[model samples]
Target chain A: MTETPAKPPARARIPLGQRETVAGYLFLLPNMIGFLIFTAFAVVASAAISLTSWDLLSDPEFVGFQNYIELLTDDPLFRTVLWNTFYFTFVSVPVSTALALGLALMFNTGLRAIPLFRAMYFLPVITATVVVALIWRWFFNPDFGILNYVLYELGVDSPPNWLATRTWAMPSVIILSVWKQVGYNMVIFLAGLQAIPTTLYEAASIDGAGRWQRFRNITLPLLTPTTFFVLVISIIGSLQVFDAVLVLTDGGPANATRTIVYHIWEEAFVFLEMGYAAAVAWILFIMVFLVTLLQWKLQKRWVHYEA
Target chain B: MTAHGMNRRRFVLTTAAAGGAAATVANDASASSGAVSSRFHAPAMIGQAQTTLTWAVPGNPDEIAVYESLAEEFMSANPDIAVTLDSEAADFEKFVTLVAAGTPPDIGFATLYNWPSFAERGIFLALDDYIAQDSYDLEDFYEQIITPYRYNGDTFGEGELYGLPKEIAIRAMYFNMDIFEAAGITEMPTPDDVWDWDRFIEMTQQTTIEEGGRTRQYGYVQDVRWTFWQIWAWSAGGDPVDNLYKPTMSTLDNPAVLEGYQVFTDFVTSLGTAPPAAVTADQGHSEMFAAGLAASYNNGRWMVPLFRESDFRWDVMPMPMKTQRAQTLSGSMFGICNGTDNPDEAWRFLSYVVGAEGQTRMTELGLLLPSRKSVAESDLFLNSAPPTNNRIFLDELEFAKPLPLTPIYPELEKVINDQTDLVLIGEKTAAEAVAEMHTQFNALLQGA
Candidate 1:
């Protein structure tokens, strides 16, 4: 005897788009929760703390904008640190970006061993900043440092005390930062270069364009978006330079290399002025925001986007 | 298809909610771990409750081993209490972060300079009650070393005992005997021989050696930092501040202070007796001295262990006197955290560390001068090692003054250090540097 056919299971009635949305949110939930708790919450809390005078141990006292007022009107060190940070960023970012682009162009020759050479150049980016700073500190030593020794051997009677002299301390730091950072930007430039079609260069060559002419007209114009990205990121990174300065100079030889972040750190941790440090942090945020905004606005003038 | 999609969406939404809830549970568990009681119940097998105390200390590997052995001995004696050592270099910022997080170590080590700030902020538990209850003999410690842990009204060293001294440090001159002999100096200055400023300079210049347009050896290398500079200024009958505590004004503009600063700066910028700022900037005073590149190095007892390993002969002598023989007193001390859940257990460990046993162990290590009177005076410390004149550290204790201990000491230090660097580099004269330092320091004090 034939048994009654088993009824087929009924399917769910939800829409595909809704299901996908739920799945997407589930995947993002973990990271979103972390970001909200650690980053977003911390930012808001720091802003609140900035309005109050809190030593780490004592209960915070509400003091409105007193910290900001004092820092702006009375603190001579504040002005000095602010100027030093600006000088570091302005000098390091452009110089490093140019050096990175030049290196990237030289490396993109499609040679048999180009990958090896590129990896060699990218080694510093993978090294720890503390280690790099320490090594550079020794190299910059005026007495037995290899840098000074080499200069002495080259018939130069004396070399500047790179990290100790006021006139040369910031420049020494800038040189170190460039050496440590150029590799990362170079990789980015290489990636950007690879994304550009070789057909454009071929056509230019057929049109009798020389190497310099093609690079100036086609390569540079097309690389504007990448250049803008590099410029913005480099400037932001330079503004927060602390590890190198902390290890190399300790903001010494008369605060020659004391950047804003270092000042904030000393105020917050060393001096135990958490509230003032928070205020300085906010000032830094505003300064970075303005600079980035200016960069975005100015990008339209030169950053060409390919259709 | 529509029904299937709807069911899938519902399932996804449920899963997502469950995941979020699970994450919340996991976060709560992690957060609670910090506050968890470290006591482990063992069904009262030993018929006593077990309590754990965490001690945060900073030292090198050898020192840490010594501490570990001490903990073992402490645990064996006090079986009811378990001790855990948290080894870290003394870092105030990290300590503050731990306190802010509400999980401060039960017992922690703080430098003498930082003890006041910690006490003023109420981070440390005043040990008066504990000391009174235990009848701990505070007089057993050298008054100079223990004075730093006392916090009085608006100043350090008079109010209440918040910490106990772990070790006492006093700065003196460490001379390279070989270098001095090579420079035709047959007789080295002893602790009793009080060299004046002029005599000191002449000896320093004589010890310096130059060859092939480069200095092979420097006569003296002053640290030029605030702590050492204060010693010079004090010996010259001046001080950075009128009072070490509750300082309302800077005494940097005192003529004697200027004279002291001028003498030190001239070593680098004028007399060329010492290595340039550039040279010391890299090699450091200790390294240069140890490497035989300098005839004399100015540092505290902490350099004993480092110098003991050197190939050259060296010894300690009193710092030259400009007006009076003065030395700088600095040290580390152990304090119980105010937020500690186990204050009694912590005090037991803290007392043991700064007690006779602890000081004796440290004396054996020779890294620091013991704070205990018995240990400091006994052959344990006095006859220690290479520095046959270890007595100089104790002999000068009476003259050793604490670095300024105001809450604003760090800020005051930065101002003086920065201005001093300018003087050392020849960018600013002693007069100009001290003038600026005075104005800035006064402002800091007023603001504080």
Candidate 2:
């Protein structure tokens, strides 16, 4: 026993200060509760309902994957909605993000009245979605509309019926959505741009780097975190785009603008097929989740953070 | 009888009127006492305390004034119950969202068509108890007006009374006098004067005017979903909904309906007498007519003020018939919500709405035909300005058919609009569109 005691027992250590841990946990509580309420439990409940069949009035009857099987194999409307949503997401996100970043860069310069220009650019972000949709609808109007009128003056023949024509309807909505949302993302990008230390750019410039080289090495790399954030958020948002479509198109011109979320709404509330709609909602959530996860996984290669 | 006995009988009748099918709420006399009874006559008893109850309505500024006046009258009668009328005014769509959201106002003005959706959601209360207890008269409400409230022949809510029909719009046509004169059509289109398919087109063509090489004014304008086409569909003997909850599009694909569609499209496009694609182009033909751009417009009686305010002189007539004379019955109803904490208060408000006093007051506003058949026959609505021929709407009440009552109307409407728009824009033929519509509508129905 004396010989074993010679090998000195190691003392168990306790952290003296809990300020960092407490602050971290305190900050985390809000998100944890929010996720539990809005996302986690919702997912579970919705998934359970998805496996069953129910309208709002009747109690749910468990159908055991019948809805999913039908959604995957049989439902023609589902395919159309999936296509529309994918088309919208694929087209809108990049165009809007690039435009926002460009605008942010333009406003972030050391120019006079930058704040005024920023405010003007952010006007659409602050305006109500319904108002934006209405104004855009009028602008895109065929006969008395300012859009077609301008095109007529420019000597272009046969301007498309923006809301009424199938070919142009989604494009029209996409344009409206980008215009409405770009201002919000631009503000975020501007904040990210401002946070980039000037020293890096100066160092790059001194090392025989041209303007393009300096930007390539410094600005883009430094802005990756912000870009990643915007990408994730924008993707999530575009998947759920409803108000503009509801106001402007009502999923018209042969259901071209009928996104997945719109289909869910139409199915659940309008058609009163609650169980099938719950299935649709769960499917949408999974799709959005996977897409976000994929982006997160990809971010390891592209996104760089200092700390 | 003693004054107390008379009041007791009055309370019994009111309860009967409020309770729909299975209630004898006259026995709930004790419940009506206490807080409910006090709130019911709070204004008369308390002499003014100023409590505001929310009211929802539709239409623009002037129409809002009518509600404001109604609110003022209700407040004046009940000084304790202050009222605030919150108007949606823009379109029926927002009202749907609000009601569906489950936080519907204390008092709301909504079309009866929307009541089924609300009732199915268990959001509305059965007013039968209130009616029976209050001794309100049920017979005053026209049978046709209260039809929508009945689900499986049971009134909306737990009892008979859910909503009272405040305003109704049986389909009517507005004819331009100048166009009629120019067309050499001396006889006005009337309920008695049923025009066949060819004559209707001929009359429309005769009235069409061309100026500056462009079609300035069309002979007629009608939308695919609203007033005129609905009448056409009815006249061709097609019911969109059967007795069962099935959509009857493909089942009733008579050639006459297609022929009617052809006639409508040819008039607008091939004949060049009407604005091309006008049916799919505008929200309603009344707007076109109001702008002095169309000869005749088929719409509801609500368009009277639009006509009156317009520079053109217009008069309304019964919608022209093809096979059997018919007009689509369109109207609104009032219902009490089951979740309402103040059913007695709501019953009191509804009593005034359905009573002769309220119906007469609404009639005087000249915005709608009152749901009471007696009110329609009265000089009150008929003698009003805008020259509403109240008799034509009332006379056609027998021929008035309600649209398909299904919870799936919004879906059905979308499919119909999409298909019809395709046809109007020359993307599909009438037969093709009808077939497509039948398929999609059935899929929705079966899916439901």
Give me the runs in candidate 1 sitting further than 4 Å from their true place.
A1-14, B1-48, B88-90
Poorest 10 consecutive residues by lDDT, candidate 1 chain B? B1-10
lDDT of 1 by residue, A212-288 (tens): 99999999999999999999999999999998787677887799989999999999987888999999999999998
lDDT of 1 by residue, B1-448 (tens): 0001111112222222333432343344333322222332232256788877877766544565677667767776777777666643144676888887888889987877677678778888889899989998988899998877888657776889888888777787999999889888889888798788888788889988777677778899877777777777888899878788567788888898888877878889888898876776555567789898888888878788879989999999888888798888888888899889999899988888777887788778888778888888999888888899988888888899887788777777788778878887778988899889889888888887
Per TM-score, the best of the predicted structures is 1
Q: Chain A alone, model 1, TM-score?
A: 0.95
User: Residue B51 lDDT in model 2?
Assistant: 51
- What DockQ score does model 1 reach against the true complex? 0.41
Candidate 1 matches the true fold with a TM-score of 0.90
